[model samples]
Target: MPLFGQAAVDQLLEVLDLEQVDAAAFVGESPQTGAQRVFGGQVAGQALVAAGRTVERDRFVHSLHGYFVRPGDPTEPIRFQVETIRDGRSFSVRRSTAQQHGKTIFFMSASFQVREEGLDHHSPAPLDDVPGPDDVPTMLDWVQRYPSRAGIFASAPQAVDVRYVGVPGWVPPGDRVASEEQRVWMRINGTLPDDPLIHACALTYASDLSLLDSVLSVHGEVWGPGGVIGASLDHALWLHRPFRADEWFLYDCTSPSASGSRGLAMGRMFTRDGRHIASAGQEGLLRRIGERKQ
Candidate 1:
């Protein structure tokens, strides 16, 4: 087992660098992120890495769809088995499944395509006069303000710098419920090498952090003693342009609907300067536990 020291970015890069165990199978270990279960984004990103390793360099990944079958054990290593579904003249498709203890935990289907020019357009990024990442409070600040949750917040993965654009669910202000939308500015905490695949994978890992929370914002729910219970069920991503993970990007997230014990969230990634870079969507199990509100 490899330890990722104190740097979150280093740990992420290490985990993404999988060890080839067979022609189409690879093994990856979890980082010491202090969570009971493995992060869903980590598995998705790593699975994409496994598939990308088997792909030709000329083709870059454009989209991926994945499902979370079961919670992953952080103490155990995950094995990724990739299957080549097709390889066309300009596109390739691959399916990757992640397993632990001989049981499937996560699976993904990814598509890659060669560079080509086409009509290009995107939704305009938000124009709110939001504070920059530096001006916003860090997780450490939250831990200090809310000492009861210090251990949990302090132990979270520190690979990315996250600055919430609004008050987080755990920290409410004067009973004012959060708006339907949630925004955060995030990027790799430290500098990363110039590898496009590594950048893409790192962004994928960061994308999952606050998506579901957007749904909670709508219902004035928080993750406290009697908060809501939620877990991601499935996720998908579409890359629109090339970008670096080390630079600041605003993750604008919102929930469109919640029903049948599930919630759907959609997000768009934009550079600080307003370049729409990517889009992500996820559906998660969102159940209200404990006593219902009267």
Candidate 2:
């Protein structure tokens, strides 16, 4: 069974409730890879679950900082060890380390604050004049259109629905261009519970998709047979407000720098109404075939 499927993730969520410290130790193993690595979103989501379990229901997570150290093996179970850094009247802090085979694969620190009204100021949301997810073609539809490159989409986990305004590189150019920015509509494929922590985790998982590719867009390198190799090195996110994961969210991404075989990209996630819900930044290893020697 796929570790990233809806049923698998749902089952994993049941085993890894954040309230009990022992539940934090719950790890979902991949039946295919047999590697002990945990899913990046899973770790982020589970960590948020762990932190949320400790705080009052009214106080939601406002921000989180995490680092990915190594690829988790799916075969082995990941142990989530939690640390209560501080507890205060208005704020609480917690740190978690996800370990596999006794090796730390990921580390995270999250802060929660009691809900309070405050002055708000933010830049106007970007113009989403483009078509919405339903208006655009589903990623799966595109994959089927090009059966030869179906493996790429086939390998992706099915927890989220991805609709690309610009077709992925693997597909033959059917009205596509290499732009510095990429737009996509994303949301949980299924109805997610109202738990804010679950929404945050779902966002974290969705954040990683296509972020690095934004960097590739700058160089006109889309994923294909001759495309460059890219993998995320580090990911950071800041949640600004509360939102639903099951609803369509717009992700606008841009690449500011690509040098020394590394690319940096930043993203802003917004609700359909243009409210800024969260911000994300990532740096990754981008290397093109044959270009590495030159």
Candidate 3:
């Protein structure tokens, strides 16, 4: 089986290391993961890391809004420019732009706040009596069973270990129609340094995975050889509490709406112990094409 081992996780951590080019300007590199375009989650996470690097440690990121301006070229390095929008006593706002080949490819706005006691409340955890990661089918198991159909996944350098709770939506449907909801258990493949930003960035990378797949489930669009075509248009995330990305987290995802060649999916992240930690939403371009003739 292909390994998403310690080396892979370290490679991701290395990708987040940014170099300061000038005042408020930083440089980041894309890992050669053999993807056609840069992963949107990587850009979002790096931008947030850059923004956080410029702020005080006591202030943590509470929320972020980002747009995918253009598909990034994975072969080249990206430059991040951060703008300090505000720095009040309790809140700081920052804007980050990622540029490559002299063009803007992505941008994001993030807000950070100093920790304080507040009236805390959250929606009930959606997961119930679900099997844990050890009991689920890992991505490698799927790839091994249907190599011709899921070969592309095997080629990518995966930094996170993913175990789907049920058959993936992208798998060619048999008697069952695709489901509206999807669940997966995932965690960073290896231990990370004790840094909250690292954990946040790791989760940020994991967030983009399978979000649009929820949309695919609704349309019965499997991914491979002229299947569904899609790209994330915009993504938003709210961090509710501190959590370790290296530990197992259940990602419960669902597609609530699809219209005009677009789909909206939301996900809630919960610890194995059922602590609701974060919420995410994304809208993506989703279209179907005719099956390929072999």
Candidate 4:
């Protein structure tokens, strides 16, 4: 079933609340891959939620670092183990490992801090002139244009509303341009509860969506012949400020390097008003494939 919209988001929140552990143990056995692969964003968001639960309510997650060890099995339940790494006066740290079928699939370290006064400084916000997610075409509308490739969009949990600033090139390849950056507008598809943790986790999930493609764009390889075998290997994020997830935010991504069959991309997320809320960085394996072998 399509995992997006209100139903899916509500179900995910239910699971999150009912299985309220210091860590998350989710089972996502892919009916397609037949492998129990944990979704990287899910693990990351769940880990952040776990860490947030342990800290004071006012203390929000400020940064997180995670590694993808092995492809997770979606069919089997994932066990999340959380370690309280540090609890200082202003900062707290926690480490979490997501395991499935007796094997580690994801590991993450997160830091939380009580909101405090600091010299606020950030790079000039990008895409302040772009329209919000509402003004752009919904992802579902785009998916209908290519029913055959709908699986990719359908498989994703649709808690988020993603609108590409430009036409998506997943099928019938769009204009291939060589640039080091890409832009997309995103926001929660439904009203999120007031819990700050939920907002943080939601942001965690949204951050992983399309940042890596910025790297591929630089080589004119995005949606290349047979497309690129792109997979995120590691993801890191630094939250600079707090904001509502349901509000429209622009994700401006840039690629600084691509070598050794790996590409590094960084993103800065900003509210429509030009407030820099968070920054994300990721490195992924981008191997060009000759044909659809998977």
Candidate 5:
């Protein structure tokens, strides 16, 4: 298999690095992919970056909740506005908002905390139960095998290595559906800086990529054409343990319910050695059109 190359990875990092126009205000630009709307992950990550920039270096983000207020325009620059909520001795809270053309596109409230010893008991990940990342096929490989099924994942320069445990929702009705149980092994395609905030921000970006896929899998649905169409409405994340985004981690996701044209999915992140690191959840607007869905 060919390598994804560091070029794409570098591009991701650059995107995360925002320009500080003023205190508590930052400007960010999107990749010129020429997509219809800005990716939800990019805006979320950028909002986090803006919030992280205003806080002291000692504190690290532990949790974040964000809402996609409006669709973003990729061709325009996003302005991030951050407000200091509170900064206690052990904890700090910040609110970050992303605006395009003076209108809010995304908003996030993040909490940061200092390291403190605490009781820890987390269930081990099923590493032995599933195949290692090396044993699975890459997104490029999946696209190669199912060109008809590959939607936007068809190109190269993949920044993150996403290896699905089984067939993804994008695949037509298959032997197994990930919606019942969606797990993917992923990591940055290249090494990242040693900054904890950067790692957290990068993972924040990756977290949004597939959380919604589980909802699609619930009905064995695919994207585009006759499949179900959806848009993420909100996202939430919590970091329980430290982790490096450049290393391999497993995202085990599942959908609790799908009603009123809305679907909810939750996921947990675990290190390869089975340490539970983080948890992520999202809800989206899903609508089925055409005869393929029925």
Candidate 6:
């Protein structure tokens, strides 16, 4: 049985829990949030779930690479077709394709592996000089301090709680303060099932939350009016260690470059105790709405 906390998390769990339609296929539905488009992370997580179901339980996901082909209409249910790419002695690879309106919207290739002894080393945790979750302000605190900055995100708390270490991406361009990086402490905001696959999928969903914010932070730009709007083009992740989604983890991200209206962001997640767990990279289209296109 899964531990429980927020109703929002329960809803998120429901969204991640797909309906099996065939031997290697599943159907995922969107919550009626009246949003115009499906969240890229949501589709990616569901696709991971679909792929996970077809693989051996002992094998945990080690890496995934995904490309967002099209925007999905939130009003429609998505169908996932999982293909068994390869199942080697200690590794398994699967490809998941998400389709809506009979058209492919997103697809991912994920590889899983069984436990094995291996030499290991990772970069040191990046938050040694940063404040802990207790010191960082929550969304409510932010709203009270900078209500104007919370334009598109001035809603109720989400299943996943995110606390930025500094100015968030919602800060407009005119008021922007460029930063070298974006740091955040986040978690599911509730208890989750103990399944490793579930935790991995949850992390997959949460990884997309503020990655692009790093790109925005680079130039002190925000999202929305007077700022820039964007969409994720691709997301990739590599998990090096096991972690629980319900536990607070630090996500440290930065943007190395931007050109031709595209920005690339890279990030890593470390446990509160300072174990480096995963690394994520994404490239997205970041275009200013007021700017004219050729």
Best by TM-score: 6
Model 6 over residues 1-294: C-alpha lDDT tens digits?
222248879888999999999999999998766568898889999999999999989999999999999998988999999999999999999999999999999999999999999898988897679999999988667766777767535653377888999877776567668898999998998889889998999999999999999998888888887889899999999999988998999999999999999999999999988899999999999999877764
TM-score for each prediction? 0.93, 0.86, 0.94, 0.88, 0.94, 0.95
Q: Candidate 5 has which clashing residue pairs, if any?
A: none
Tens digit of lDDT per residue, candidate 1, span 1-294? 222223767877888999999879999999766788999989998999999999999898889999999999999999999999999999999999999999999999999999999999888888467788888888667767776744445666678787788766666334438588988898888888997778888888988888888888888877655676678999999989999989999999999999888899999999988899999999998766674433
Which candidate model has the greater TM-score, 2 or 4?
A: 4
Can you write out model 2's per-residue Cα lDDT over 1-294, one digit (the tens) per residue?
A: 233446644654453454353643444434343323455666666666666676667677777878778887766656777788888899888887777778888788888888788998777777546777788888778867877765536654566788887766555433346787887888877777777877887788788877887887776775555667655677788888889977888888998998998899998887888888998888888777557443
- List, residue by residue over 1-294, the lDDT tens digit for candidate 3: 344789888888988888888879999998875779998989999998899898989898888999999999989989999999999999999999999989999999999999899798777766666788999899888878777777547777678898888666557555225777878898999999898888888888899987777777776667655576678999999999999999999998999999888899999999988888999999998766663422
Best by lDDT: 6
Over 4 Å off, model 3: 1-3, 173-176, 290-294
| Model with the higher lDDT, candidate 4 or 5 | 5
Using TM-score as the yardstick, the better of models 4 and 6 is 6
Superposed model 1: Cα runs more than 4 Å off: 1-6, 172-176, 291-294
Off by over 4 Å in 5: 1-3, 173-179, 290-294
Per-residue lDDT tens digits for candidate 4, residues 1-294, read 566677766755654442554343333322233223556777778767666676778778889999988887666656777788888999989887777778888889999888899697888886646666777778888788766655567566677788987655464445556665788998887888999888888899889988887887786665535667767899999888879988889999889998888899999999988899999999998777764433
Clashes of 3: 0
Candidate 3: the clashing residue pairs are none
Model 6 off-target regions past 4 Å?
Answer: 1-5, 146-152
